[model samples]
Target: MTAMTPTHGGPWTEEEFLALGEDNERTELFDGDLHMTASPTPWHQHVTTELLVALRAPVRARDLRIHAAVNLRLTPARIVIPDLTITTAIDFEQRIVPGSCARLVCEVTSPSNAATDLVLKMHYYAEAGIPWYLIVEHKAMTLRLLQLQRGTYVEHLTAEPGGVLRMSEPVTAEIRPESLLPEH
Candidate 1:
């Protein structure tokens, strides 16, 4: 695990907080602060599963690693469980180990998580130095890609159902939004 030295008033230590994730169902620790996730709706799981299938192929072929709903240690005490994430196998093992290293993070927006995904979680991922972030919206049937530059999201590529998501890092890949989404 990558060690982090907590600042004067930082959240709980990684060990102290992550230890709670095993039994807790709704709550997750983000940088030591607790964040409670609402029960996921069926739509959320459907999209998540579809996206996972789309991603799993490229990752498996290249032997790269990815995870689902896994806690990522953004810092010494700050941890966030992103819905889906991709990272290098080595970095994944060394920096995050049994948790996550999350070079690319994705979240399916739920009514309860839209603001957090667009605002709070966006800042947290940027601050933690994740290279890319993807937000998929259920209502609009859209996919948004954000690439980090200079500690902020500098590039954005958005597409609706028939649009293609072209990406070539962490693993070269393309995704047809419709194939990875449920019919409305």
Candidate 2:
């Protein structure tokens, strides 16, 4: 059984947060506190799986590794687990991947952590100098590509169900937003 550590209060150190995560898969350090989330709903997993399938070809073509939810060390104070991450390294380090090693980080948003994916992670990734960040919305079926420019992420592409996102910055491919939706 996993040891449960409470982190509701503010002001947490990196080591303390990691100790909590040693037994908790959902523990993410954000805003200097541990943010724990409930297990994702079926719909959230569906969207994440679909996106991974759609990205397979492009990911393999570039000789990059595609990983499911994994620890991403965005900063000393911020350690997040993005839904999907593409990295240039073949031998990816287990548990924590340095932000400098990631080619692109993608997060499929669930209601439980949409703000963390869209807003909080954006700032963290930008600060880490990560080149690209992708946000895939669960219900709306939108794929937003944010490219880091100067010192921040500038919106590159935002595609809805009918639209297609032709990515060219961090990676290159044509992605249809509608295909990401799980069929009823």
| Candidate lDDT (C-alpha), each | 0.73, 0.79
| Residue pairs in clash, model 1 | 31-78, 31-79
Q: What is the lDDT of candidate 1?
A: 0.73
Q: Candidate 1's residue-wise lDDT over 52-78, tens digit each?
A: 888898887777777877767776666
lDDT by residue (97-174, candidate 2, tens digit) is 777788889988877667777887778888888888899887788888988889998888999989899987656788
Best candidate according to lDDT? 2
Q: Which candidate has the top score in TM-score?
A: 2
Q: Please give the range of 10 consecutive residues that has the lowest summed lDDT in model 1.
A: 1-10
Clashing pairs in 2: none
Clashes of each: 2, 0
**TM-score of every candidate relative to the true structure:** 0.81, 0.85
Model 1, TM vs. native: 0.81
